[model samples]
Target: MESQLQQLVRHTRVHEIVGDVIRVHATGVALGDLAEVQNTDDEISLARVIALDRNLASLQVFAGGKGLSTDATVRFLGRPLDVVYSPNILGRIFRGSGEPMDGGPDLSTEPRVKVGGPTVNPVMRVMPTKMIETGIPMIDLFNCLVESQKIPIFSIAGEPHSELLARIGFQANADVLVFGGLGLIFDDYYFFRTAFEEHGVFARTVMFVNQASDPLVERLLVPDMALAVAEKFAVEENKRVLVLLTDMTAYADAMKEIGVAQERIPAVRGYMGDLYTQLAQRYEKACDFKGAGSVTILTVTTMPGDDVTHPVPDNTGYITEGQFYLHGGIIDPFGSLSRLKQHVIGKATREDHSQIMNAMVRLYSEAVEAQRKQAMAFELSPFDQKLLRFGTLFRERFMDIRISMPVTEALDLCWKTLAECFEPQELLMKQALVEKYFPKDVGPVAVNEAPIHG
Candidate 1:
């Protein structure tokens, strides 16, 4: 398909091969440009230019470099890597290399769009004032996920972060969901697909998966591929898009491995110096277009050894708006925070939402202290006893990750939890909210009364 001049530019002198990377002395090659490596057997493989020094260009072959010989013919495509972007992509599963893997249909003829584009301009972005409710009480009641907000779920291995994320995917109030799974095993990959299908959201979802056995270069492309498709849906189709990426630590590890292969000097913890910038580039893709729809990013960032100071979570904490601390199979109220929740706490939600949230969290904090006192065998005051009761009700009703309810229902339940353990006047909340929302029939019950189960 190439013109004679284009064919003349093909270079056949690959000088070095390192892991999945190969070096060749070539001109007119730009970073990120696509290339075609044709072996002597005429077997062709795709590659992308990763680095350029003088006349020597380094590329990471997509199929890998194991079978590639130094005499392979390299032809620069003069374009960056791109992914298919179309409504046809919905309900489809793609590999990290942008190839269709769902066995549904061929997307080779679909229109393609370049990945890793620049972030939306500030002037074109709308302020994040709208709330995107996920039926989870912990998030909806305390830390609201706002439209166009970028946040991460901070967790460690052995946690049910994937389950929580899948719950949000099916329950979140979004028109489309884009999921990127980095270094997932077959079981996790199957779990996500089956969850979405069973929940009837698979038709509106697109999945990009990079399993543990996939090439490392593909792992680096999953985020960009997912974000690119999400932006297209938000901007062109005018649809609210929620992008979910799990185990970004694996993505970071791929970058570290590629850097080592390139012989680049390591920064902190052996990660590249541009670690923050690379993360921000993808996260900044979350934006509410002024006249169109929005993109919200929720990712899972596993902390190595549960250490917050680990380079991945530490850098992420700086780039993201806030974090949902997932620990002990529940969202920890003490550590979880949503900085943009203030934007919609009262304006978009009910009038009593703010007061109820504050009072409940304050009571829960006291309940934690009361627990310590009881654990130490200290004499408990009646108020401490009340705090202890409120804490139990709080965990069963709201803290449990399995509980799902609407914002209004959760607010009403909050009042009931308060009234069950404390007098209305003792709430220290706005007097009018107490009068309106406090359960009318429920009075202070005997401490020995049976607790309500969620």
Candidate 2:
């Protein structure tokens, strides 16, 4: 005869079966009163038992769902969800359930572990000082990416956030790249896979992808799997891992769906009340583990209608250190920033880096105002006239996303452009830097340099 605990779990119907409400009796607690849910399509990792009665047990499912049946069996496992972890997870992919989707091998045979664990205490945290060079001029020269840093690419659905993530994965100085895709289109998945393969970094990269076609619950697991694998690599293999997650909005939406399933009171915007805490837990995973390689998180948050005030972005903005805003094709310098850049800019990079970045953006902002004035047909002042020419050159030369140059070369180009367009005094850079960096003026020639005005 089976034990009473086993028997209790066996008879109880999975709350998710009829809806998302489990039933357990007081005696069931001794037999691990919780019921194991049988989710045929989506992965439902047990989170918590929020509300429980003598006959009813309400559980929170990590991966939210829409198609669960209340009649499904909820057998008590007497345990929480666990995910397997190890340095071996590198170059691997997983579903939101932390199950392998890479067509390689099943991790079921290996010991499984849990994701969304508690973060490290602040007392153990060390100040971050290492720089991660992506070779992207906008990122490297201005807002330098740092180890253990958390940054988000804030964009709308149509923007090229995935492209940017792939670019960083391929080029970032980190030893390993773990990519988590949630609610991604098939094309985006293919694009990331192709980009890494073409760059020959696919072997060093792990992709945990939850496509738009996958179960919404699965989409929720992508980040946890990616982070778990990254944590293993960081602690055991001593690898500097960069974890990239996309479209956190989908993850939040999944939460809302699951909350509805469990009949929990909705918080702001129908999101779970724990939204901020949930985000902080994941983002706080970025850490420079003592005596080990660091883990950095650079995820994408797509703002619906480009509204930063949207809950997803709004919460993310508070949690992440900084954001890289992508609009049109270029990373908008005005909109993007790395708060940790202060740790690297000028201090770790070239001395001219900080000044050049500041000068360039200041000029760009002035150009925007000038363009607005131009649009309004305002009479241009001498400085505004000069700004007009500078703005045109800035877009064609610097702001174009296709413009890829080494950090040093980009700084030199800035000096050269200024020399060509304006006298040294107009540049407003330090007098000493002007003398050292400013390219030599093309001196007047007798007749060759002069245009013959007839």
Candidate 3:
């Protein structure tokens, strides 16, 4: 039964078509409202109102506008776009359109929740104090991933950013994982699915994927759908949710393409001026709800041509908590940072965690300088030799992305690595911590020793 309002707002007059966007002379249309566009052949495609100008509305068709006629009927649904949410969605894979991609049972009848809503109230959010361990020494030991923190891994092409994301997805201590892949190739998509299934974490994971061949509008929806489900799990089910998004650069590009189609004025580097606002809206979804579980977001923002000043990463830096700079197949300790780490470094972790992190990074800085001097063929010193040896061991043992271990075990190994090269007094750490944690029976580490395991 069509209400009087719906009947009054229906129009069979699409004035213009540009790419996947259509402009219609329809009144009483609201931004973000979902509409059904019925073509001349009676085929209905979903569209969402993107912009409105007195009695004129612009809609971006979800299923591309290849065959959409100018006279297609546009009927607004009087509501916003939504995604289905329920426990049954676990272990299931969904397309960016929120349809089931896996060959499984239908979920169309499940409960649906509106996405892209306002962020959680500031009063309802608690201070982030809990740590989410990823079992990666570079992350867990040095740059701690605090619960409810929103962060990104900044990398360029040819880096193993996806591999690092998958490792954290399977190994991070979280109750549910929601993965959103934007503009992924078939091979990259397959790798994430296979990694989750083989590692036995798929049962607790939900995937929203938009492949390179999919419609551009769908790419923008992937993050919203993933975050919507994660918010439900956190507030309703009281579960700690971790949302992982890869290649947000793709998402921002989709917005640029759509904005160009709409003939809107482009901002910096041909991107929309609202790029920061859009990214912040999604990243701010990460929160620790008071008296409920938390939602933490970790994203991959690839810098084109390794340009840090690129619009996507430059705007993201201001919106996110911090970033993990992945370069040369390893997480660079000097480039990566976790701003909220201060909240949990000593409170939620071991007593020696704070001192150990500072001491090791300080020593590694000196080691880097020593290597530079050696490269220039400068005068050799005994301390410089020791620093060189420590640098080699540090890279081999801790900097490798493949190395995974609990924070405690990694901290212990840090002490051993230090003791192998430098004396106890040389470590400018607290005398008490040094006396307590310094390796007592220090000996040469075997070259064939197995890498640390989680």
Candidate 4:
């Protein structure tokens, strides 16, 4: 019976154009089948019927239209946007849309999997305690990277965030590095690739990058694609995976695009209301699979206008364990924190690790105050003089992100630097620690005078 009315097949897959993206579900179609998409607003594009669907068909429309008439054809794509996946892709780079950008040959039907899917089960979770050291004192010495910990480097434009990520990729003691670069300019992408190749770590790393010129929607798929590959490696190959996702703000902006497309109601700062849930779904992927390897996510979330309360960073702060704040060409000691460091610092490191770390920071903080006093032309006490010295050396030696050293060497260097600046009593450290770490005065002050220059 050919009736004028065609019922949307019951139990057929449906997708809601909510949240700027319409995700397909088996029964989601039934919910909006009666719904019609019409070009009510001049801004919305009128969707053309592509196919009639019970199972999957194909649907491509001109312009993203809000008032989609139910009478409009909704031919399905038979599947979600499938992404190619294979172990042979371990050391490759790809565009945001999952196309190889590394000038490699086509994957040639190795098999493709969809990105941006649901997370693994929580019951399969394992507590985090393992440490992935980058050999950079600012990170390894202070904010220790724990296995399966999800963290962010909060920064703005022009920070060495990209270089820092590259350093970690090369130095971190992890089996795999899966980097998802979202919305990077050409030079930025070029830097990462060159850095990895120069260090000869390209064989162990993989990148999924979305550049500034690519379609905006493609940016949304990068992190998910990178993570998807990471998850597979961990569960199947038991590889210790370190996933680095840069410029999360780009991902957030993409979310906003799809949200507006679905005509979804906006939440704080014009982002979709489900911001937290979306971030959590991605970050919660950091975990140690039982009897297998782990996944640790370290991401870049650039603060727009340097405002921490900018909706993107504000929400990310809640999701990640803590942040490494990059400012003023340095990883700010005060702003950077590792909430999970408590679990691994003393346990995974040396016995005096906690004490030395705390004491060093306390001394550095005092040094800052001394420097400020010096700037005000205040008379410098002997202690102030010592602190001022310590602060100068601290910034040059430890605080500089470019300074890389083993954790033990860093501690030893700390002791040496302190001893050179002040007497043992002035340090006020535990006598036992002094006795062990303090260098003995072997000789009097050296006289290397090239005839005193006035």
lDDT of 1 by residue, 354-427 (tens): 99889989988988888888878999999999988888878878987889999999998898888889988788
Per-candidate TM-score against the hidden true structure = 0.96, 0.85, 0.96, 0.82
lDDT against true structure, model 1: 0.91
The runs of at least 3 residues in candidate 2 whose Cα sits more than 4 Å from the true structure, single-residue gaps closed, are 1-11, 15-55, 59-72, 105-112, 441-454
- The Cα local distance difference test for each model comes to 0.91, 0.74, 0.92, 0.74
For candidate 3, which ten residues in a row score worst on lDDT? Answer: 445-454
| lDDT per residue (tens digit) for residues 1-454 in model 2 | 3676565556444533324334334234432122455656544444345456565666544333345555544556655446777656656766665667778865667755566567876765678888988867778776789999999999997787787888888888889999888888889888998999999888888888888876565676678778887887887789999998988888898778767766779988899899988788899999988888889999989998899998889999999999998988778888888999988777767787777788878876786787777778888787776666666666666655545667678788878766656788877788888888888964211111211101
Superposed by TM-score, candidate 3 places the C-alpha of residue 205 at a distance from the truth, in angstroms, of 0.5
By lDDT, the better pick of 1 and 4 is 1
Strongest candidate by lDDT: 3
How do the residues 187-206 of candidate 4 rate in per-residue lDDT, one tens digit apiece?
A: 99999889988988788888
TM-score for candidate 3, residues paired by index: 0.96
